[model samples]
Target: MGNRILIVDDEWNMRNLIKIYLSREAFQLNEAKDGYEAIEMADQYAFDLVVLDVMLPDIDGWEVCSTIRKTSEIPILMLTARDDVKDRVLGLNIGADDYLIKPFAPEELVARVKALLRRRKKDNREIDKLLITFNDLSIDYDSRETWVKGTRVELTPKEFDILYTVAHNPKTVFTRDILLDKIWYSEEFRDLRAVDTHVKNLREKVRKAGLSFNPVKTVWGVGYKFNRPEDQY
Candidate 1:
């Protein structure tokens, strides 16, 4: 079955708004109004994800998120009317795995949901347990270990994030800005060199593993993709 998700908000329209789009897809959906009812419904059933609104009459979303995190590791994405950077940081500090400010595109909402699920699915396994194998190379996210055939490789945290992002979506080209945005969450990310630095590091690491280092391919004026010669087959 697809994941069941809970949407908690005091406004009926807001709750139903998300539900309408989500239900059109494959997710099993449920809703609760106010923080008290939200907690009650959450306790009543197991949920794969929680979409919470910040404003509630009975209580705030931050407290509800804190309470949920105290007992469970279920992924949470918070909804807020505030677009302030401080508000976003606060939500992340409080336990929201992700956040969306008001007036976001439904397509973006769906994309964020899918990204979170993909991240969770990839992260839930032990590094030694989940090896991403293609051609002669492999990467283990759980252990932060990578290899070409049987030889080991070393990677920095940023390099690993870069590698992991492309590896998860092999053959999908990414622009420099796309890679930077995906790997880092800096609000003031004007220095574009960070992406270049990480890509250089990742390429060297793959080479050090005794492999041909042909996996991470550049797209000329575009960005790059983690692809092998056999990816076309």
Candidate 2:
């Protein structure tokens, strides 16, 4: 069977249009007309991706995305009529993987979907290297959890991704732009300060959890790098 995809939208025509376009790719498709149905289907079935529309009868797509993120790391492609940067940023910030404005080309939708799925596939390939430890800091890739001094420290999805990316490449300086491209996976939002904000939050979280050393180090005028000193090993 092909990848399972759930399309969530209230409009019958929009749902039908998406189904027609995506069915050609051999993806097993499902439909939910509202946020409640979407959330229920998402919880009940194992879907590879979700094509979500922001305007829904209940709860809204942002809530749906956050709800799903709380449990699964499923890729979400958000559809919105409003092209406001704030709206797009809100969706991305809430855990939607990618955003597409309404009236988008069928080909563009297909391309973004394929790109997200490809990225997910590539991420899955790293499952074997599940856990990495650096002194008191530890990251569990499979569980998407981080531990400091044997105590699990809560991290937002983006926070975890940023930490993992830097930690996996110790001593490698990552400019804000590089981290945005790698973690956001979309060029739509390029606010460099977002990286700094996340890193700050991640640092505080781990620090409050009893970590002694700074896990993410800042480079003056450059970017940031993992501070895995020789003693960490």
Candidate 3:
């Protein structure tokens, strides 16, 4: 079967237009007119991507994106009439994979959709062989599982990726922008603070797992790097 995509927008004409453009690509398309319906559809179905509009009758797209990120890493392509830099950064920080301003070309939207799906496929393949360990911190990429001090640690998908990326390259300093590029893969706009948020969550989770040390360290004015006690030797 072709890729499944959900289009969430309050405007019928907009949804129809997107459907028309994507119909030529063999996608199994679904539509939701409001954020409420979007969430319901997302919960009930496994979509390859979601084209979400910022304005909705119920919850806004940012809220929907944040809520979805809480449970799923399904790629989101956000649409908005606002082209402000802050809005774009906010969307990316909240977990939208790509952002398109309203009045965008249909061709551009299709291209972005294709790119996101392609990246997702590549990422899945990469994760299958990923296993990184630093001292007592261990991460299994395929299962998206992490352990610190031999105890399981729960993490959001983004958090796990951030941890794995830094830990896999221990002692290597990764600026926030570099981390975003490596993980998010869309660099049109940058959100350095988002990296900090995930790192904070990762550290808290590891701490709660009874681990006595932090594997991730800030470089102060640079970025972040992973280090272990034995790395000192």
Candidate 4:
């Protein structure tokens, strides 16, 4: 009836303390003493979230997160010491959905967990599954998969979002400003670069798929446009 959470820590007391604190919140909680146990439990159980400690006996949280990411996008929340900002960033870069420093309040943990799950659910709801085809490249939104003439293409979430936006409405020119508003929450000009980067990355991925065709075209100083095969100059 509640969200399932796996708390992985070498210290059993720490795990138990957190479990007691979280129990009132009605989360279906589980625990693992180390990364090895975490992985084994994860492989055997379907947990909605994982709260992973950075320091583990058999394996560290970073490796655990990376290993899990190779197979699943299930949300991961890493635990790092207060002084380890680099560790926090590393966790994020390595596929952790979020991170909390040591000695964090139980209530803050609850809030962060709730916020992450809320955002993920909102994102999932916005995804409309459609099988879009242009030339040899076809995108299936339902499975979150893309293909070029039968070859699969891997895309990050942002890259996929950018491609989906433009490809959904072919031939429409979306200015950097407009795209920034559409793809990112910030209206700042600095965020415009992110849109450009995602587009660039998307194009490169398409190129890697052995397709000579580029669906997205820059509109000089104006914006970017999704060019259908027949519409390209």
Query: By TM-score, who's the top model here?
Result: 3
Cα lDDT listed for each candidate: 0.82, 0.92, 0.90, 0.85
Give a tens-digit lDDT track for model 1, residues 106-134. 99888888788777777666443456777
Backbone steric clashes in candidate 3, count: 0
Q: What's the CA error at residue 33 for candidate 4, in Å? A: 0.8
TM-score list, all predictions? 0.54, 0.57, 0.58, 0.56
lDDT of 3 at 90: 93
Whole-structure CA lDDT of model 3: 0.90
Candidates, ranked, TM-score: 3, 2, 4, 1
lDDT of 4 at 79: 86
Candidate 1 off by > 4 Å:
127-233
Candidate 3 TM-score, C-alpha based = 0.58
Across residues 1-233, which tens digit of lDDT does each residue of candidate 4 receive?
Answer: 99899999999888998898878889999999999889888888988889899999988999999988888788998888766677778889999998888889989988888887787777665653377888897888778788888998999977887777788878688998887777676654456677888889999999988876888889899988887877766
Candidate 2: give its CA RMSD in angstroms: 13.2
Please write out the lDDT profile of model 2 over residues 1-233, one tens digit for every residue.
89999999999999999999999999999999999999999999999999999999878999999999999999999999998999999999989999999999999999999999999988776663677788888999779999988899999999999999988888699999899889896656768998999999999999899888888888989999998746344
